[model samples]
Target: MDMNASPVPKAVVVGAGPVGCLSAIALANLGWHVTVYERRSDLRAGTHHLLAPNTENNPRQRSINLTLSARGIAAVQAIDSALVERLLHNAVPLRGRMVHHLEGNTTRQQYDRGGHCLYSIERGLLNLILLKAAAVVKNIDIQFRHKVQSVDFNKNTLHLCNLVSGQELDDHFDLCIGADGSHSVIRHHLMLATQMEYSQHYLSHEYVEIRLPQGVDSSGHEAYLLDPDHLHVWPRGSFTVVAMPNKNKTFTSALFAPKSLFDTLQYPDTLIPFFKTHFPDLLSLLGEKRLVLELQSNPRSQLITTKANPYHKGAVIIIGDAAHSMVPFYGQGLNCALEDVRILSILLRKEKDGHDPSVILRVLNHYSETRHEDLVAICDLAMDSHLKMRHSVATWSYMIRAFIDNILYAISESPSLVDLSETIFGPQVPSWSWLPLYSMVSFRPDISYSAAKKKAERQERLIDSLGVAVGTLGLGYIIYSFINLNRLF
Candidate 1:
């Protein structure tokens, strides 16, 4: 160590989830001394031991499996390619959605024609990987079981209590980041300190987890009960059940339905029958006994969509779920959170003299200003996607539009078209770009969420106009034929 070295900037991060841990790593890489506070104990130490002995037999003790798309992969790759590789190693690639219909029928809808895929990874495993990576960083200090009590933004300090020792401590820092998730204490204090406009709305629907055990295949090898390469969905009009494969050969499924529907199944007797009527195929696989046990044991979790304006006040900034929490329909919650870290790191790196305390405020202000629009777009998309997944995917009109979109994408990416256009027109002919809304949101990290929404809206309007024109032409031809027949009579 050099005696003339400048002191590193200090940062306090609340929460040690994926977003929080990644934020700590980003800050540490930027020459900031980071301290991370997590409310729960170190999850790297198996979750089974943390639960009560009696509760160890519960199957739904984990979170919904996370879907990792291009946005998330790019973010992790930006941090460290090796980290991304490790995460992918444990992931199951899902190329499309397998829509399960009534009478045991199924149809597969590919996400894109170009063979792009999203990886299904367990949330707990991903968080553990991030935590382990953060642990080895020289400048990061991770303190599990340190629950944040409150934040004093005026004094640039955090008040926390250690869960194990039952001791309280106050820590001052040059900057504070709140990645503490939906029920963030830091965000709570920031609201009190500043006029932070915030609103939270819960969907009428609720979800419950169901474990689909692995079964032996014809080859006498363990395999997923359903197609592991696609995300399986049993979509009813008002209710839906989706499943994603795990590395352990089993599938983690979630049942999303209206509160009214969930309420009707009050007893174990009603539960199995309801599954038999709605999801007959799943009922056979899950077994009546297992379905009843899961419904009786697991609690239904409400889906919430939260939004806030100006995610920063002074030197305190909020990221991930603390800033915007959306429903899981779009599978972009974690991806968006990871993008938050990536974007923030880029902005900080651009500020060459960002080590100064005063420069920190400018970096945070820029982040909040630029990030809010994208967050709003994604939240709205997630809400709208719920309806599409439940009903629209099975519609003929939706499938036709998807087919048209794929054709457009293929044309846009064709090298022959580019060459032909350049030769026929000029050497400076610009390359054409076309993408489906899903591709834009899930695969294209270069496009902003707001931009993607605008592009999709434009495409929708064009399709609607074309449909009307085609309908008018058909109606005019029918009227003409009727007039000719009447004249001949």
Candidate 2:
């Protein structure tokens, strides 16, 4: 059978966020008829709820701005390099983290020795850009305000409602891709069809969105209240405040704390005093009036970590948060989700030589089996990073180790030296250089999450051995000096 003469496969993508939009784009580019169904109003139309000021009564509308790294850009680049260029033009580059101390001090921790950095972009803005790109594609149809009520994986059918017109309809597809996020309706339906091991854990902590407006600098020109090149962080032990810059000179900040602490700060009297004590510098940046207004108005959202095994069943598959949702501490949730699109695209393209329906199923099954290990590694990594962001980043011991490791990395980068991977593992491991865990995850798209985790563990063991060797040498020198002093006496 001629591949070109075969009927084009049709795919139904659930959810219209960055991941969903990217999925639609990739599938369409792969010669599939793609339709994207989004439950919310089109943010591109300016009617989306996120455009309005977030209030206490509003649904979860606040945007947790994304930190775009190598993995995410790789996905977009696969579809269109121009789209990557457009998105980065609108984003502010985050060189590293700006750690604000309690004692009125700040420190910068660069992400990598090689100068790669993440880009900070608004969530709604990113979605709009993707939607615009998808709109231009001839093979894609985007349906906004369409809610998925139920799904039958075996039948490959979906029951959907038009949220705007109150019309309900049933749609069928050759393939179904679920990107509807952590609380996905498609995921719920998938569970009914198969015994998918699933689990969700809600952290005791919650978060509220806050805005830091531009302020006049010493020269009287309006400027960013915080450094635009860094992701500003106020790590206060069990709680933390993070701020990411926007192109408009303002910043979107979030306060993450225990729900018990949130309960105590129900009003200005409590909230103001709490900020004054723990985050005095940020209090001044936000100002007393605006601080109280935003704190009281913004909804407090719970943080959740979701995991599911075998992300596919029959012809249906789940990607992004629908399969594995992690906390934002590591800032890889969006990056990882976008990477799913990239990985899936590679697998699906392999079967393009022949339009065999069975080949598609085999590819999906292979994806589910192979992709889970990397996703699980990242989900666990994200959970562990919460402690690092809130506590370890501020500790003196952590700083010292990071400094020493960075120095070692710099030395290893010399042209005269052998590849770090070969030096550590063996000559057969190829020439990948050593990097810090943050660098490996964020800067190296070629490294899988599982490989990065395993490599980081190996790096830690090597460092421990070096520490012991250095300590032993110092002890031997001290003993010799003591014996020589005793002989002189």
Candidate 3:
């Protein structure tokens, strides 16, 4: 029953975030001795933390940007099917993105024609689910307020400081995983082991979480104005406000803008005015009094972008935000992190099984070298999607072209296209360790990424040609009919 029992190694995981919790559970499932160390006090005591908060006294809120996309759902389902059902029941199924414009025009773009939906769920809800799942694993032990101060990789030991008791701990384990997020102590130790190429950049964008309470119509009842099936967005070029429905019949909303914009807020200043102007419907939902308190009280988080080579042999590995952190505009940050766990877990089972310690080390290293491209691809795609959502929706050319795409897609039938959508969203594809989204999503047996990419190009070309040909034929038919009518007259 114990997959790791050959050596019967003890594994210590740093951080109690979603990725760390999942990693601890996965290893414990495979019979590894998993002990999770977290610096935060018992959240059981209702302890909530915002990485950064304002000095002003205001009612604080708990909110995070998370989109459960197809790939993310698959990653989650692979780990636990029960969780998938529970999450689906709790989440607001986002059938598509609802783009709201300055001129009061709204557009809906569907991810699939069959009404298949991704979801918008609160990050804290999802994390709570993962933590609860991990809590049930028999071999997993969790130590709250145990902050890791240093790591000794050569000796495979850790020096930890207890945040609550002001105590210190030195412990040994077979593996050390730094799921402690972007500012990882374990990752810091890995820098001492190898020349790790790492870069972290903070985006000009800053995010402030707000709430859009479900309001009632003129009748004495509560209601959600917008379609609960969609993720709502008011893209204001450089700044934006987004509303995603919650199970509580409320929608958690966030406003993202530059710091300069927030700094220019005066007494009775433009913040509320701006919201009331650009997001009239939303401002009405989140009352003016509550909006002021939220902006003046809640935390303003800096958007960070990070990239790193995650493996330094068997001594260290980083998952989730610890490796790559992108702006939440694309809504894949947490999803990508969960997907990382899926990849490493599969790789550990496939390549490390029955291998010597040294052999396992080599396998881990190989997986690291291979996973970079997919990381980059996803990171890039996430970044590009922001442009399409925030700015392109307002462009005439963008609207026209997207409509054309919808029409062309309607006329075409590609097994690969259908398979591609399913595979990307399906939970059964092999974790190729490092595979393209299309290849991994579609699970094409022999199609290399280069070939798949070329095919995508050809498909696009064919769709464009069909659109042109059909338009021309329709025009010709119209002219001929007009000539016949004239002759009859």
Candidate 4:
């Protein structure tokens, strides 16, 4: 250590989840000393089944695997490209969704025409990877099992309790980041300090996890029963069963339905009959004995959507689920959380000269105001996606619209039809400018959530008008032909 070295600024990140771990790495890279405080013990020391529910500590253990897309990759790549590569190396890439119909037939729908894929990675695995990365950073110090009791933004202090030793202490920081999660202590403190508006909504639907183990192939070798390249879905109007591939030859599946429906199927008699009626095809995959066992064993977790306005107060700011926790329908919950760190880092990088009290507050306020719009857009999109996954994906109109959108996108991406593409879908000034809504939201990291929603609205309106015009022309032709046939008769 040089005697003439300038004192490094310190930042405290609450929660050692993926978002908090990434936040710490980003801050450390920005020449700040970071201390990551996590309430849970080091997960890397635990077994692969880290998502096992613990009703005593965490009732809603996130068992659903996360879909890592461009937004998340961009964030990680911004800090360290090597880290992104390592994460994806362990993740399973999914290109499309295989929809299982009532008649035991299946149809696959590609997410994008450009062959972009969503990486399916377990939440614990992702957090573990990031935790390892954070561990290697020289300036980052991770203290697990140190729960934050309260926060005082006014004094820039945190009251932390050591769960292991039963000791309590106060820690001060130049900056405090609240990445604690949906139930955030720092967020509660900020709410008390500032007149921040916050709202949390629990959806009527709940989900329980199920497992699909590997099966033997013709060669007698273990293999995936379903196509591992695509997400499998059994959409039944009001409820759905979906599965994402794991690195192993197996898959983690979930059944989502209304609370009322879940209650009715609590017993084996009702549950087995219900599965036979609605999800008969899936029943074959998950045998009667195992389905009942898993369904009964796994805790049914509620889906929650949280919204908070002005996610910052003073030198403290909240990110990820702490700020906005959306349902996992769109699979953007984790992606958006990762993007929060990227956006915040960019804003902070702009103020490179110095971060005084006022300057930090100013930057935080701007981030809160601008980022809120994008967060709201994604939260609403996630809710809408839930309905689509549960009901609309099985409809003809949905399939037709998806087909048209993909065709338009493929035409736009073709090198030979540059001029034609430009005419049909606006100017091709920016790459992926003519992408469909899903492509823009999932594959194009450059487009913000709010911007994607706006563009999708415009595209939808145009498609609706074109449909009406085509229908009118077809009706006119039929009427004319009918009149001519009557005259001949």
Q: Which candidate number has the best lDDT?
A: 4
Q: Scored by CA lDDT, what does every candidate get? A: 0.84, 0.84, 0.69, 0.85
Off by over 4 Å in 2: 1-4, 47-60, 218-220, 353-355, 413-432, 483-488
Q: Please, what is the TM-score per model? A: 0.93, 0.92, 0.82, 0.93
Quality of model 2 by C-alpha lDDT? 0.84
Better of 3 and 4 by lDDT: 4
lDDT of 3 by residue, 381-443 (tens): 566667766777667877676666555445552323323211322232232222322322223
Alpha-carbon RMSD, candidate 1: 5.0
On residues 54-110, what C-alpha lDDT tens digit does candidate 2 reach at each position? 132355458668899976787677667788999999999999999999999999998
Model 3 alpha-carbon miss at residue 455, Å: 7.0
Single out the weakest 10-residue window by summed lDDT for candidate 4: 417-426
Worst 10 residues of 2 by lDDT: 420-429
| Model 1, residue pairs in steric clash | none
lDDT of 1 by residue, 321-354 (tens): 9999999989999999998888887778778788
**Candidate 1 similarity to native, TM-score:** 0.93
